[model samples]
Target chain A: MEATKKNSWLTENRRSAIAAYLFISPFFILFAIFGLFPMLFSFYLSFFRWDGLDPMTFNGLDNFRFIFSDPIFYSSIQNTFIIGLLGTLPQIVVSLLIAFALNSSLIRFRNTFRTLIFLPYITSIVAVAIIFGLVFNNQPFGFANYILSLFDGGPIRWAAEYWPVKFAIATMVFWRWVGYNTIIFLAGMQSIPRELYEAAKIDGASIGQQLRLITLPMLKRIVMFVVFTATIGSLQLFTEPLIFLGRGLREEGITVVAYLWRDAFVYNTFGTASAAAIVLFVIIITLTAINLALSNLIGRSKRRVS
Target chain B: MSTKEVGEGKFSIKKFFVYLVLVGAGLISLFPFYYMFVMSTRLNREINSVPPPFTPGNNLVENFQKVTDSIDFFGSMWNSVIVSSTITFGTLFLCSLAGYAFAKLPFKGKKVLFALILVTMMVPPQLGLIPQYYIITTLGWLNDFRAIIVPGLINAFGIFWMRQYIEDGVPYEIVEAAKMDGCSNFRVYWNVVVPMILPAFATLGIIVFMHVWNDFLWPLVVLRDPSVHTLQVALRALNDAREMDYGMIMSGTFWATVPLIFVFLLFNRLFIQSLSEGAVK
Candidate 1:
């Protein structure tokens, strides 16, 4: 009787295990075909020259060599970093301030403010690009130029010029994402214990001092998280610049991803594009590692100071 | 007492300054949407008037007509709806099932599988874009909805998110109890586990819907036919073709944005709470 019961339990265990596998099989199967295969294939394709029509020729490291020697490739990286910094710096700072304000007890209709601020985030980037294209039109009658005119500034060519184009694209990035980062910061702020603030208050710490000392210190991890994502996101910037400057290569505004897209789709150089993608992947991973290390260093230094 | 009163006055001034900053930021945040609406109601000439149009004009109906005539505006809208909803529903079902297994079911290699999902979440999807497009072409799925829908039906992030929610929201005792009643694993998932996790489903569903709806790059790459273009793609075509027609372009953008904004307005609090919660997690 005991032997039979043990065998039945083993059968039931096997059945449940099979059932569990069945449940999760869809994700693995789909991911293997769509996700993992594509990733591995991209690495393989980076070595061979193909134009979607001709037979692929093995080129060894020629694709990588070509990209390394390409001036456009260097410019694309420069543009990516410049625009990433332009967009991310203001976004992080402004989000922190807005989050601070919203967390204050003086604010009424808090949810109303949050919804209004987050409105921009929900809109499509294509729509934003279209609207902002006109708002920042190269023409004198553009809204931004009009506002600049009020301040006795010249009507700048917002789209065509170099710095202005980067500024315009960066503005769109900031507008769309500021609220998202604010909400995240607000959540991080809310998680900090109330007693810390109370203790600070008892010690007569002003609001600014409290934020500088207690709140900022307490929210280091969340700040690093936001900065890390922003770094990665800013590197992969595409749609805004793509829609802003059209599909053609615009030296002033073309980004790394845009360059990759152009190479593969427009130039029909899949191998070079694949090489570019791998390079971007490495850049992203390296930057992420650097960010993690920097955050850790900051944490350690702050701990020593405290 | 006099010093305390002076301190209170200073505090009120600071508070007023804070309110000023908040209200100003709010208006700036909303200005673009207002501008879009205003521009949609004006003709191109009026849009370019010395002082740009800040209020609605009588061209609202006219611009709407122009939008539909220029491109298949409604057709693309319908395409977006079909794609977004199908992907949303598909993701919720598949992700929730996988999440449940990872969260509650006892299985060999569960830890390794879940770890693999987490690692994929870190691998940027853009890395595989080229070869993924190639694969879609090879399978003859290009220009078909399946190209976008099938690959997007399940994702590592969705599975990871659902597993986290399930582990926290659903208790193990209930899973065991359902099994004690001789309920099959599928039945437990469909009947018992699902109802308890509606909020997670809603959150993931909205996220997927918004993502697929707003997606521009992949659709632009795959869907080449004019009739099959998604709204984002069609809008891009319109912008490229009619570069000077501000009113018509704005009108297309307005209509494309209205459905989402309306849904957002109706569920404002839920959207805010759930999104912030998701971010925090």
Candidate 2:
């Protein structure tokens, strides 16, 4: 009787385990269908030559080879880095400063300012991009040029010029993102004990000195998180450039993902787009790894100093 | 000597400067929206005038009509509502279900499976676009609402976020008691766990809604039929076709963004509270 009861208990436990799997099985099923299979297929497609509808011809390594030799590809890579650097670096700094200012006792109406700043972030990118297109229009009467003309500047052909187009897109990115990073940094700053600042002030430290010594050091982890997240976001920069430059400067403002989209969908060069995507993926992973390694190194040094 | 007095005077000066900077920043932040709204009410000629229209004009109705004509604005809006609402509802149900399982249930491979789910969060959606497109095409799902809704129903981030809240907020003993009362596991999850995790549901729901509502790329890729396009996609079409019609485009853009603004204002407190709480963890 004891043996039978123990066996029945084991069966009951097994039945519940089966039911639990039934409940959570959707994720695995969906992942297999949408996530894993596509990734593996993309890898396989990278080594072929096919215009999406045609038979994919096996062309091992040719697409990758072409990617290296293509000047446009190199330029796109250069543009990606420049835009990423221009967009992410200043955004992080400005966000940190704003976060600090808001955290300071000197400021008032903190929540209002925070909400206003964050509004741009939550706004639809398409709307913002369109608004910015008008603002940056190369016409003599464009908003940007009109403002610049006040300072005795000539009307700039923003879209026609390559660097100007990149700069315009970067500005939009900055405008939309700085507040988001500010909010994140502000959260990080608030978590730092007020006693740290109190003690620093007691030792006759100036506000700037306290920021440099206490705020910066304590925010290292959050900064790393911000950097890595921003790096990934920057690598995949799309819609802003797409709408800002429009159809004329497709190549000029072509981000990597935009390029991938054009190749895959517009030109139907699915295989090559897959290859480019694979390379882009690899670059992102490498950069993230480097960021992690650098953060780790900095973290260790900071720990030793403390 | 008189160091305290000097320090107090300097501190007041610093406070004055701080307010100046804060107000300036606030103006800069709000100026774009002002410009957008002002431009939306101005005609093309007024918009292009040498000085440009700095104030709102009386072209709001005209621009609204133009936007409606340029794109099926109502149709696209309805599509967006349907798609975003569906995704939000699906995400809440599926994520809450999986989150509850991971949090309360004692199941085999629960730890390993949850870890696997978390790993997907790191893989950028862009990486899978090519193959996902292929799969969608193969399944004949292009332009189908299901194409947009089904694949993204149970996202990893939602599940992870829901799990985090469930783990922290929901008590496992309550679930045990429910089970002891001859309730099935599903019943325990539904009656006991769901009610307790409403705040988590709200947070995840808002995030998911905002994302789906504003999503441009996937919708742009999958939906080829103009009739089936979402608001963002329709706005893109209008933007491309009528680059010169600042009023119409702005009006359309304004309409597209207004719902989000409403949602943000409505849930502003919860939004900020969740952000701070999530960041702390």
Candidate 3:
């Protein structure tokens, strides 16, 4: 009887395993075809010179060497970092403040504010870029310049000028993303226990003191999450700048990803584009690792203190 | 008594400052959409006039006509609908199936396979664009909708999200009970597990739809024929044609953004609630 029951159980388990594999087979098949094979093939192509038509010639490390010496490659990198910093720093500080304000008891219609702000995030980036392009148009009647005039200033060439192009792109990035980070930060803020605030208040902590002592310290993990995502996202910044600067600005604000797209698709420099992409991937990974280590250290120290 | 009064006065002043900052920030956050809507109604000359019109104009119908002529607005809209809907349904079904397997079924090498899926998330999509383009071109699938819809059907993030939802939301006892009733493994998942994770399905559905609808780069690369172009790519063609016509471009943009705005307004609260809850995990 025991042997019969054991055999039945084994048979049942085998049947379930078969079903499970059948269910998961689609993902495995698709990933193998589209995801894995393409990745490996790209790595292979990185070592060869191919222009999408002719037979690929093995070039070894020539592509990498050429990329290193290329002036346009360096400029693309500089533009990406400058735009990333300009966009990311203000976004972080403003999002934290917005999240803090929403978390406070003094705010009215809190949910309304949160949802309204988050609307920008859900709007299509292409649409956002198009709208901002018109607003930043260097014409005499441009909305931004018109506003500047109200402040006793002349119309600024918002898109044509280099610095203004960076500012315009950064502004769009900030507008679209601030609400996303705010929502994330609000989640982090809500997770903090109410008793922490009460305890701080009893100790005669002022509002700013409580924010510094109780809020920021508790928000370390959330901050890390935001920073890491924002950093990775900044590295891959393409669409907004591509639309805004590529069309409105003098093509001088091309991001690294945009540059990659132009080279691989437009210019057909496949090998060099692949090399640039690989370099970007390495930079992103290194930055993410540093962020993770720093966050982990901070988390450990906070745990010890508590 | 004087010190206490002083403290109260300072607190009120700070509170006023906080409200002021919040209001200012909110306006800045919302100003672009406001501007887009305002610009869509004005004519080209009006848009380029000094001290541009701050309010809505009466030229909306004319601008709409130009927008339609510049791009096949309805056809591209249909294309977007078809593509986004197909991908969303495919992702929901396939991802849920895989997620169920990872969460409930005890299979050999499951841990390793799950880890592999996780690692794929870190590999940026741009890295594979060249090879992917070649593959599609070689297979003669360049202009086919399947090129966009199929490859992205079962994404890593979707699988991971569904697994997370299943692990937390569904009970193993239900599966065991279904088995005792002589139900097949597929029957258990189809009848029991899927209903339990409907909230997750909705959240994932919205995100996937939005992404596929707004996607520009891949469609631009793969689909060259105007008939095969999605809405964003079609709109880009319009922008290129009348590069200097701010009114027509703004009108096209305004139309492009309307559907999403409508969807968001209808479900914005649900989205926010789900997002907040999802973040807790």
Candidate 4:
């Protein structure tokens, strides 16, 4: 019986299936322990209140209740959107322009230019935040201040107040990511048919007109992708604010993720942190779904127009 | 003839403005980096001075001493290397194995499993922040390097990238020929599929390595120890200790950023290709 079973298992389909199982086991195993378990535990923890050390006491809707009344949480959501718009809007436009320029025939040394522009993305964000902190140091001799002095403007508190803190973080976000989006746009542009551009040129369309009529419409899907992804990323903005502020859980520059970090680790309010994480996660999913729906509508409308 | 000449002049002027814009954008991207390098060399006083020295300062040795004196800089970097390199190689192995199976092997549930993997790739992994900490501490993995490394080894994106690459690049005829010669599935993958996908390996290696190297959020959570801290984590500690000491923080940042920048400069062609190819858009 054993011999027959072994022989049966040696069939090609069974053998390949076994091999495939072995090959794919690592990801499943790791994912179970790391990704799926953590996500489930996070959701589960939202219902019960537990510090890192003590046993969990079951609390019904307390975490959610607390979040609703927390003024800081509301402001963090507001600050997050403000920073998101400030960072993402310009990044999209600027990177789009750069990608267009890089694609045009007038540019030389394209590879060199591309490498230099992408340099910021590769550096550590901790480093970027620290560097920007000093550059925008609200002192007489600071680089930003010196530039301001040239225009008779006094030193601006780039990190002290609410708006400047958001501005500083937004600038950091824009700096690190603009090149990445530019490259994406460049790839999207490259994927378009050259014949379209040739046709536009033959039709006496100038560069700006060609860009408006052909390129932007063609890039709708990619633009939606950028918007949704940037929304998700901006919602989770943590490191820059954390480093820039140099204080634990300061009110001025706290993002939702930063707030989550403080509640769990600083205040040992793990349940509140878990609730906030879930809230942020829900927002991200909703935004991405909306973006997808809008993009689909535009896609269909364009198809109808054609 | 005169009208055409005027139009040509106008076009040249527009081209000049485009170049100006492109060059300005490039400078803005790089100016912070230049500032980082310059500030790293200056003392606190020099950085705080009225003229704000643009040139390099002679405080290099002092700041280097101050940084190492405060933090376990080398140990932290070694931990970062171990984490990133381990994840890099692990992703290459596991991702390729699964990718090859998905693309080449006639396996049961291939479509279902591959679809699940692709689905996971669509969503961002930012949901379980505090809960992740709970699980990590429960597993008694706090302050452990494995906490950072093990959880990070498997990524759906890496698997997707490998599958797409293998399917597009690797021909089926050779895989069939190897199978006909009585090679087992694993051997066929090990001997034939991997060699054919070297360029894919390089691109994936760089990407996986870059992600692991630059990963801050997760590592910041688990790596509470100074010894096991990655570069970014360590730099955070260093900056906090020498708070407002621009020289020390900048020097640390400069050194921490140098290795990846070095590698990037060397393999820019491969590096940029990976970025563009791996772009979600």
Instruction: Tell me the spans in candidate 4 whose CA falls farther than 4 Å from its real position.
Output: A1-10, B1-10
Q: Is the docking of candidate 1 incorrect, acceptable, medium or high quality?
A: medium
Off by over 4 Å in 3: A1-6, A152-154, A247-251, B1-11, B276-281
Q: Over the stretch B13-104, how does candidate 1's per-residue lDDT look in tens digits?
A: 76786687678779979999999999999999998877887889999999999999999998999999999999999999999999999998
Q: Where does the lowest 10-residue lDDT sum fall in candidate 3 chain A?
A: A243-252
TM-scores of all candidate predictions against the true structure: 0.95, 0.95, 0.94, 0.95
- Which candidate gets the maximum lDDT versus the true structure? 1
Lowest lDDT 10-residue stretch of candidate 1 chain A? A1-10
Model 3: colliding residue pairs: none
Query: Every model's Cα RMSD, please?
Result: 2.6, 2.8, 3.0, 3.2
2 or 3, greater by DockQ: 3
**Winner by DockQ between candidate 3 and candidate 1:** 1
DockQ leader: 1
Error of 4 at A275 (Å): 0.8
| Off by more than 4 A, model 1 | A1-7, A295-306, B1-10
Give DockQ for candidates 1 onward, in order. 0.64, 0.55, 0.56, 0.62
- Which prediction has more favorable DockQ, 3 or 4? 4
In terms of TM-score, the best-performing candidate is 1
Q: What is the DockQ of candidate 2?
A: 0.55
Interface RMSD of 3: 2.5
